[model samples]
Target chain A: MPTIVVDVMPKAELLDPQGKAVTGALSRLGVDAFSAVRIGKRFELTVEGEVDDDVLATARRIADEILSNAVIEDVVAVEVVE
Target chain B: MPTIVVDVMPKAELLDPQGKAVTGALSRLGVDAFSAVRIGKRFELTVEGEVDDDVLATARRIADEILSNAVIEDVVAVEVVE
Candidate 1:
């Protein structure tokens, strides 16, 4: 089976309060070297078919429609793992 | 070069309100097929060294110490992409 992982993050236009909160917490936790945090959704999907163009296309469409808030966020990437 | 991705999720014990909110929105958006949402942190790191056992180990330690909240969450996986 091929696993498809989607990472959805807030668009640059929107203020990511959640990410900002996490980033502040991380700073206190000693990850102070990195200054910002961008929180996103990661979906791990196990599809029961060969990983091909068609499957990838379907996954991309799904990501655009249901997995992401296109108005405020974007799908960063869709990765395939076997 | 190889990229290392880390997935950090809340421990089963902690309540994931963000995930719950997302799940609710997904259901409203017609993904009624699934019922829950689980949010996690995905880090994409481009490392300087070759992707080997030593690198992976170092990466794992980093995840445990800095990337993940060991007190409440866990590092589910560390994936290497070439």
Candidate 2:
């Protein structure tokens, strides 16, 4: 089974409050090497059947419409890990 | 600056309701190749300074403590993408 890994990140123009909060917390934790931290979502999908062209298209559609918000996020397939 | 990527996923023994929901939705959407779907978190961190042992150690600590729940989620540093 192919495990499609989809990465969904907040658009660059949008302010990521969660990321900012994480950075601040990290700074307080004495790990002061990060200038910025962007938090995003990753989905690992194990399709039961062979991943054909149709499956790929469906995955793309899922990423864009279901997994992420098109307006606030940019969904990209990072890879097929397995 | 080096960008460190941390991936956090729910433990295998734990039931992932979100993943299950996604799988159901996919099946309903006519993309019935999935046995399961695992949703996780990805963090992209641009450390301001060089990534030394201390930085790495801190990153590990951050992953273990802040980024994920050690009991429920398994956190791993998947890559150091530039």
Candidate 3:
């Protein structure tokens, strides 16, 4: 099985309220060694059969078109992992 | 900088409505080669300075206690990436 992982996060320039909120909670919970916290969507897709360039392309297309909003967010990384 | 990526997913026995919805949308949009679709969370945390075992442990603790629900979900993977 081929697993496609799409990690989506807000653009670096934009302020992430969710991340900030999490950071605040982390501080309250006492794990504040983090300089920054980024919260985003990580969509994992498992494709049946062989994993190839076409699958990679489809994953990219889905990540770009369906997964993350290109305007304010960026699909920072997309890859196939074992 | 050390970045810890935590991938959280629902237990295999659990039903994932979000994943199913996405699968349905994919079927409608025409890209359905998936045997099973599971939706979960990926948390990206940035710790200041060096990334090490302590960081990894903290990441695990956070993933287990903070990011995911122990009852229904599982932290499938955790790693420190460059």
Model 3 DockQ, alpha carbons vs. true complex: 0.68
Interface RMSD of 3: 1.7
Predicted candidate 3 versus true structure: per-residue lDDT over A1-82, tens digit per residue: 7778788888989998888888899999889767777777777788888888887888889889977799998997888767
Better of 1 and 3 by DockQ: 3
Q: Which residue pairs collide, candidate 3?
A: none
Please give the clash total of every predicted structure, in order: 0, 2, 0
Shift of residue B29 alpha carbon in model 2, Å: 2.0
Please state the CAPRI-style docking class of candidate 3.
medium
Q: What fraction of the native alpha-carbon contacts across the interface, defined at 8 angstroms, is recovered by model 1?
A: 0.14
lDDT of 3 by residue, B1-82 (tens): 7788888888888888888888788878888765556677767788898887787888888889988899999998888778
Q: Residue B76 of model 2: what lDDT?
A: 50
User: Who wins the DockQ comparison?
Assistant: 2
Superposed on all Cα atoms, the candidates' RMSDs to the truth, in angstroms, are 5.3, 1.7, 1.7
TM-score of chain A of each: 0.88, 0.91, 0.89
Deviation in angstroms for B75 in model 3? 1.0
> Runs in model 3 with CA error above 4 Å?
none
